[model samples]
Target: MPEPATRIRPMGRRAVLTGGAAAILAAAGFTPAQAATGRSAGKATGEPTYTLTVMGTTDLHGNVFNWDYFGDKEFDDTQHDDIGLAKIATLVDAVRAERGRRNTLLIDAGDTIQGTPLAYYYARVEPITKQRIHPMAAAMNAIGFDAAALGNHEFNYGIPLLRTFEKQLDFPLLGANAVDQRTGQPAFAPYTVRTVRFEGARPLKVGILGLTNPGIAIWDKANVEGQMTFPGLVEQARVFVPRLRRAGADIVVVSAHSGADTSSSYGDALPYPENASTLLAEEVPGIDAVLVGHAHAEIPQRFVTNKETGAQVLLTEPSYWGRRLSLIDLDVRWSGRQGWQVVAKRSQVLKSNTVPEDTEIVALLKGDHDKVVTYVNSPVGTSKEAMSAATARYEDVPALDFVNFVQAKAVKDALAGTADAELPVLSIAAPFNRDAAIPAGQVSVRDVAGLYIYDNTLLAVRFTGAQLKDYLELSATYFKQVTGSGPFAPDDVTNAPTPTAPSGTPDYNYDVVSGLDAPLTYDIDITKAPGQRITGLAYGGAPVGADQVFALAVNNYRQSGGGNFPHVSTAEVIYNRQVEIRQLLIDWVSAAGEIDPVAFSSVDWRLVADGTPVVIEG
Candidate 1:
């Protein structure tokens, strides 16, 4: 809680000038004498100043300890960063001790449940609604959260589960944008006001507004479609910020489940951009700071100048999975006329690895953590041979083929007696985790779950051959253009960056398509530019006709425009059972008791330069 040094910059012409004569003198480029005199006058008048510290965490994703349920060990990254609420709790206590417990407030920007196996076990295996408390709830409540914004993933397990998780929380789970469809009113608490009291001074009222991403409408459409609606973040902030001011809040802070960047992965499916936290700060007045989430990026401090008022709003995102904590300190001054005003503010992110896990939190959730560990490690089936996804991004591999096979077969069997039964079934699978592997002789739930990391459910969409070709072309953009068939490392050719993905196309965005009963063969001619990479597309060893129809087994993320993939979002939905794809793979293996790649693996696709196949190494 030591005050970090901040570089000062001039505010815009329309900036809202606060904090008595000292701020006005500084803004007007007056001499030091004038500024000091203004400060002395304010002090002589007996005005009091205080620093309020707001600490926040986002995208916790069900982490309670610095443990990896999938790996059955302590979580470790290349950076050696520690994870979970246990570490965050230690950091929180340190901040509170330094800044005074009453002066510091702790809150979270959402994605509380559903990431690790612990969250899944509670949601699916032994549901918390069935007379049990969620580990996340227990950990967060123990840490004393003030409030939390609703993340899109909150609806992944449906509203009932989210409500149960909400009911168990000590603080409110707010979502101003998540509204009742019939009434168009907020479905959850839009904002909450907390008062910090002093012995001799008037109490300071801090208003916390919560706004969720608009993409929830597309991402969790099945869970919230008719029941609720998620409008744009900026739209709801405009309505609520003024209400907070009217409610006599001296400081306004926003816990936004949106990114600072103004971008959307779902294209124009929603009217608003998915990551609109900056826009919210700029367009909404009376907001002093914003705790951003959902992008999984680290932004220690970013100042967005409000267009209308020109007041600078501080924004910070603490990465994801409890890796970091965002701290915003507001320097406020009180006057007889204005109760309290934020005179100055700055933000910074604290690395969770710098501290050890809090013993209290570690002890509190040990039972839940152990249960998940035993569950993920329990053997479900056996594999004839080991399969790895390390090279699956640039080449066809049985590791991913097995996923496609399970998905395609499930869709085919589900539509056996339906009108779409005759349609050739194809399934799409992505190398979600490069380290994912199925070891020979044994396969556990974690093995399959690690391969398909997301909680996306399966859906079958009807697509014409022409549309399928276009979809393949879009996915082929993952690879960069290559000239010769020389040996090349996989990284040298795959994960080509585009406008949407500035860092590079993620493995999850590069899908591999395969057939259920036959091979869906194609050549990704990386020699050509994007939109022209897919070539020689065929099904059942025959060239697919433009009008030929087929059923494509796809995850809800892609089909609901998660990746901005073409055709699939607008295509007719032929089947949707709302069954999670990971669960399907687990069920398939448990029933079969064996994973034989020979039954479904095939060399269906390859990367080619012009007409010759490209040789990739490593």
Candidate 2:
């Protein structure tokens, strides 16, 4: 994903061969080392052989300070307690200790910020004191983050802020794809050659290049569109891989914030997560391995052979917000053309069940965590109706409406006096906090946080009628006709293909949009193209315009594209502010007690043309 913003797969907990994943680690033929840990890289090495232990995280989504919102006082999810930076730091230190100094490198693929409440709090109020430092960066700096790359979410705060972090960060931020809005220089260093000299012998040069999905223009239009341009992710990787080799990089590892979507098509075009066509290690001369992120899902296999190259490409992604840390051990054999070629690789999962919590780091983030406690748990306005995020599997939902209501209101609240306030606000909401239906009952602050576990702000993006069609096309990716009736059958993204098993199973794949009146239907064949599925669309009893400009609201992630919607890529943000929608939900609850159930039916669709399924625009 060369786009400034970043993007996932559907992965959840299953019975772990847990110990084998941790205790019985395999590296070519070596016996597993005892558990202790804890760690980026790319290229054709031209120098010497070396083994670089790569430890990585994707979609940390600002879980740096642990989670104050999901505290014991709120609920007993336990997902947060053992899954924050403090715990990750402990594991990282131990891993490095075993590998020894200079042999280990810590890198992040992308999506590091904007998840937990502490991150939101720090972004707005915290001071960078001698002791009270910027916790997220402070923790990364403390944990010895060797390098990191950007995610689309990074732009949610805008380029000025991103540059500020880039300038102040202690670790080098590398990226081959991110071009500066002003100078066209690589936004961060394109790549960095890290030299590790053990026993003062010849130093081993490891070249690390980072790539972010280039779709940032659509997601963060206000922050990046005019200021920057993404040349192209795959093409950029093609150009940079060789450049690293020429620069004398012994071992190369790519920290890609991009992704390969499970979806095959969008509108009439192929929807790719990052550089879908590019498989660098297999296609390029000197490249060895790649660490991927932005999908926020964990992939455990050591190697997924590239079909095109017969080259074994090693890829790893951990769960977002500190739920998991991925460790990849690369067995590098020295070569001449490329100094060190990673001949073998293996990965492990550091989960809460296997690893105990690191108490010290918890204490460090406690005060900041306390502030987080006050922010989310503290009562805001109340709701007279029950605003439960509870909904059934694969169904149009009210919780989504709840999410939309709060987010839209938050944007309106943030932009109350600005000229942009005149524009109608629409929020794009998704179900990250999916669970079996919420029993009609009292909703706590933590519960609201759970409704949208990812800490995201509200943003308003401007889109023309045509752009809206593209956006819907992207949304349609989640829905596919099961009849094989040319995939043109009626569909909703939330439903499971197979009916419920005897196990009374659940499917959490659905996403919902709210704020517009609807009686919408997509009767046309969608899979044929964008205009196909949307057989019918209207907002408030009227056909949508080809030229109408919409004031659309979305949580920072989707606006930044966690779901891969189209035209959303061209979002010209009319409302760009730092108001968290979760807090808005708390306010909504206090004002009304509970939300009366509200359904966010589809309100718009693409027009079919001549049975060819063409979606027309202004």
Say which candidate scores most in TM-score. Answer: 1
RMSD of 1: 8.3
Off by over 4 Å in 2: 1-50, 65-82, 125-132, 260-278, 304-313, 332-352, 392-399, 402-429, 435-493, 496-618
Q: Write the per-residue lDDT of candidate 2 for residues 557-589, one digit (tens) a residue.
A: 556554445666456767766566666776677
lDDT of 1 by residue, 218-257 (tens): 9888998899988899999888888888877788899999
How well does model 1 score by local distance difference test? 0.85
* Lowest-sum lDDT 10-residue window in model 2: 6-15
At residue 468, what lDDT does model 2 achieve?
Answer: 61
- Model 1 lDDT at residue 571: 96
